[model samples]
Target: MASRSFKELSFVSIFFSTLATSYLFFPTVFANTHVISIISPLTLVVLDIQGDGFTAMEYVYSTVLFFATSIILFYVGITNFREERLFSEKPLTSRLADFVSAGVSRDHPHLSLFLLAGFTIPFVFMAQMLTLVLFFNIPMPLSLVLLTVSAAFIEEFAKSIGLYAVARERPGFLTPRNLLLAAVAIGSGFLVGEKLLLFATLAQITESIFGSVLFLSLQVLWMPLLLHITGVLITGGFLLLWGRQGYGPGLIAACTVHSLYNLHFLMGALL
Candidate 1:
């Protein structure tokens, strides 16, 4: 009976926490009935000054869409770990807590650490911005190639760095399942950060009329997100297979796969 009550309390706590986080991250979702896109300075630079806007409904939907996707991805990670019985014999709350704890003793990457990995997206974005600014004049084919390589290296390394650090702190974390879950958390974080940044960019630089349309369109798509998750999984898998040697090969392979995926889009954009 006490255990049942404890589990009920845990569920309630998680539910409320999720709601609070949602509001904190996207206060606009609950604030106004209507959302208007005004001409920001970035839009002025990147586009004509047009008064267009995304409705509050659209904004809310887009935000919810990404969060839902992130939740699903994170759940997949937990499910995978559970399939391996990583949390076997533990109470529900203990299992939940262990999954998010950063230490190896818990058998999973820390939840906070996963989120911090996601925040690294901005740093990767800045690097991308620098590459564009400095090398914009490069030939399209060459530039695409450079961008692909650069993006792959930077993103993979950024996403993997946290896992590597934690593993270093606790060598036992190098196990296959733990490594995989770590990658999942990092990838999920990357997706969240990337989507948030893209939305912000669209709001500021792209016209509201176009940005909202694009955001809505993307909400239905999962391929790009899946590719990112897969890339991280591969990187983590390599680390497990090759031990120390896996680091270089894993990074290179991740970058190559990631770049190839982007190259398809680049080719379409150019041609």
Candidate 2:
């Protein structure tokens, strides 16, 4: 089998990053930026944490924002996925039933169930990152390490769950790529929503619809999408390997890699 070239991965990374950066320059994005700082209504969570809060509140608020963004982005992503037929032909794990969750329409209960759970996995994982940093009083390096490990763990956990459930009941499943597909779908979905909401900060202040749209357009176009995509892709690979090596061994290896990735940032912070 041909290994994926670094060029291929780099291209994937650049493509998403560029798409996001493009929105910044559109003439109207300038106005949208003004609006958000001045006028947009803060979500309840954001509002609640706004003043005289503990330093930890900043982290907590960020965590809540992640959830809010993940919800919208994931929604937009799934909507786009359904329309685009975004499943891969290859399954990370040959055993994972790629068809079960995806076989039915977007409205299917099974699909919805998986979608909900898939999102929660990442949301919880990210929340844990902040929790570890703040409440647990772990050092920044340790928190970062835990964050990466948790991210990988969540991805693998979701895939294995999908694989087992689908392959067990369905025969000759329709697709072999459900787990990765769903995770990416959820991640991209999170990106879309987060882009708009976060960037909307500027546009909301201006109270101009046109500005709002451009802020969104610019926000939706890039890096966050790549981050979400790359992160999911790697996680999928780890999970596939885990399934092959036996669950315990696979989980440890995956988490270690993930931990190290986060440690890069965490250690710097600590130093």
Candidate 3:
């Protein structure tokens, strides 16, 4: 066991060391500054008025926002899971954990179901960066539209991957209600994680606490929060009903709705 652990740690250390070395020397191997700015909406000319690291106030605000939203979403998901599985013989805590972890229950002290759900935040940001860097100059309006459309696919696919892994580990637990609840947990995790990461990323670029705060506030208050939940539910429902048979209709529906939701912002950006 110790030998295996040492090997794993050594591999990780080597991988990161190589990545850092490559990044330092071949920074342009990935996206350039122009492409980065385009992909990151907050780095546009408007909000990036200041140019410093995060202010103390910005840190506090972001922390509060992340935790507050996470707690609400977490509680809601767990509560819903408990209610939905009321007839099941499984204990509420185990059921809740299974739902949050997408049908698998591992015995890890440090890794909670909550943390597993939240993993999508980094996964999504990295995916977005890849797309933006590859297709940099695709026109702003079109880019936004494409982004929204593609994000639906990417996010659904990612969720499917998670579900597949967990289900493979522990089969026969994925029911319709459980799938829906799991989707909610994953989506809630994705939403909060994405928002917090975006805030920090924008803060780093613009150095403007106000801009970061405004962007986050708008997302949490108005359309984005709802849109995120709706998209995930729609996709989850489709996956629950017919995903194993086929996922075409679900993917299209979710993508279309998500794109439509993003239209307002795209138009605003253009005009």
- The TM-score that candidate 1 achieves is 0.54
Cα lDDT tens digits, model 2, 1-271, are 1113456557667865663333222222222233221121232233346542223433343344445646745564554454223444343233123333443354453455345444444444333322322322345445444445655465445434443444334533314375556556645554554444444323232134322222222333564455445544454454444433344554455456544544454444335
Error of 1 at 95 (Å): 31
The reply for model 2, stretches above 4 Å from the true place, is 1-118, 121-130, 133-135, 139-144, 151-164, 167-171, 174-183, 190-251, 266-271
lDDT of 1 by residue, 43-129 (tens): 222223334544554454334434544564465355446443452565654443344332323433457556766656655654443
- lDDT values of the candidates? 0.54, 0.41, 0.49
Clashes of each: 1, 22, 1
Q: If ranked by TM-score, best first, what sequence of candidates would result?
A: 1, 3, 2
Q: What's model 1's lDDT at 135? A: 37
Candidate 2: global Cα-lDDT? 0.41
Candidate 1, number of clashes: 1
The digit string of per-residue lDDT tens for model 3 on 28-90 reads 332234323333323332224544343454344324333544565566466445444544455
Every model's TM-score: 0.54, 0.38, 0.53
TM-score (C-alpha) between model 2 and the true structure: 0.38
